[model samples]
Each structure stands twice: as structure tokens, then as C-alpha cells.
Target: MQLIFDTLTGNTRRFAHKVADLTGVEVVALADADPRAPYLLLTYTFGSGAVPESTAAFLGQHSHWLRGVVSSGSYHWGESFGRAGDVISAQYRVPYVARVNKSGNAEDVRRVADWLQTHAANAAD
Candidate 1:
């Protein structure tokens, strides 16, 4: 498994680290990723926190799982973060778990770890 990000202020980077720590997954910046990895944790802040331009472009050009939260900061208040994730999930046939934190509280990271673990276990089964 791999955790990929196009972080600016390290908020996304910190979240990626937490997911790696929990899952023992390797971390790679989007630019250095292996396109063939079966599982990918794509993290970015977007929409009010919208997705980074590079990350969005990458998603448009490549097919991968986009795990973790999708909103910038207002996801909890009936925002469209999950909506954006749904579009990607449908297009890629990849499952997405959407989370939001106005305070950068690591909720999305934790949820991503949990989602990855579940997928890993299911794959083994």
C-alpha cells in the first residue's frame, strides 16, 4: 500500500504520516509514486480546502483509490467534499471514505487507516 500526497503546508503530510504509522504502509509523494500499486491512499485538502491542482490533474490522468478526507475545512457542515469523492469513486470504481476536520484534528487520517485495514483484510480473505 502507498500513501500519496501533494501537500503545501504539511497538514496533509502530517495526516499521511499518521496513516502510515497505523497501517505500516509506505509513504510517497505523488510525483514519485508507482502507478501499478494495487492500493493507494491519495490525500489532499480541497474545496474551501479544494484539491490541489496537481493532485486533481493526476486523478484526471490516472486511476487510483482516493482514501481519506476530501473537504478543506467545512466538510462537517453539510459540505460537498463527500460529493466530490463520490464522483471519483464512481469513475475509478475505487471505494472512498470521506472525512472532514475544521481543526485538522486527524480524524480523516484515522478513518483512512481504518478503511485501508478493512480493505487489506478483505483482500486476504
Candidate 2:
């Protein structure tokens, strides 16, 4: 799977890169991501549970190939934490793979990697 990320503070990018390293998935920026290929989107949620404009626009154009979504947000947001993942997952009918705080930890990477690997193995069959 490919890792497509959109970030302003680089937290999402860092998490995406970690997941890419763990899963051996190729990571790319939202703009550089291939729309024709299936990928997992890693993005940051901003104020009021809103997705970044860039990520939304990318999804607007390329969501057909979207496989899943992972969102990064501050835990301080409470109920709003990572809500963008929910919206995007519902919007595209893709899995909400994970909600990571800030840059995420090793366990976050492992969780996402495991989820992707499960689907990857299933797809191969």
C-alpha cells in the first residue's frame, strides 16, 4: 500500500513515514500521490474537526482509489479528536484505520501496519 500524507506541522508526515518504514509502503505527499493507485491517507485534523483544505481537495479528486484513512490530532480536542478520520472514512466508505495523537508512537505505527498487512494479504488471495 502507498502512504499519502498531508501536513502543516509535519506530525502527520512523520507518522506516515514511520508507518511506511514499518510496513515497507512507499510514502508520498498528497500532491505527488498517484490518483490511480490505491493508498492509505494520513492527514491532520485542524480546529473543529475539519480536515485540511489540501487533503479534502486531494480526496475530492482521487478518493476513488482511497483504501483507508488515519488522522492525527491533539488529544486535548476531546470528542473532536481525529474527527476528520470519521468524516473521510464515512465519505469514502473506507476504514478509519487509526487516530493518532501528535506524531504518534511506535504502537500506532504497528497498529496501522498490522491493519494494512491484513488487508494486503487478503487482497493477494
| Top-lDDT candidate index | 2
Candidate 2, run of 10 with poorest lDDT: 116-125
**Candidate achieving the largest TM-score:** 2
Off by over 4 Å in 2: 122-125
Candidate 2, residues 1-125: lDDT per residue as tens digits?
67899999899999998988877888999977766667889998987899889999999888877889999999999999999999999999999999999999998999999998888865422
Candidate 1 lDDT trough over 10 residues, lowest sum: 64-73
Query: Which residue pairs collide in model 2, if any?
Result: none
Task: Report residue 57 deviation for candidate 1 (angstroms).
Answer: 1.8
TM-score per model over all chains: 0.68, 0.94
Q: After superposition, which runs of candidate 1 have C-alpha atoms over 4 Å from their true positions?
A: 45-50, 64-78, 81-84, 102-107, 121-125
Q: Candidate 1 on 1-95: residue-level lDDT in tens?
A: 55675565665666666678877987787777655554454554555435567766877765544433333234554655435455555656766
State each candidate's clash count: 5, 0
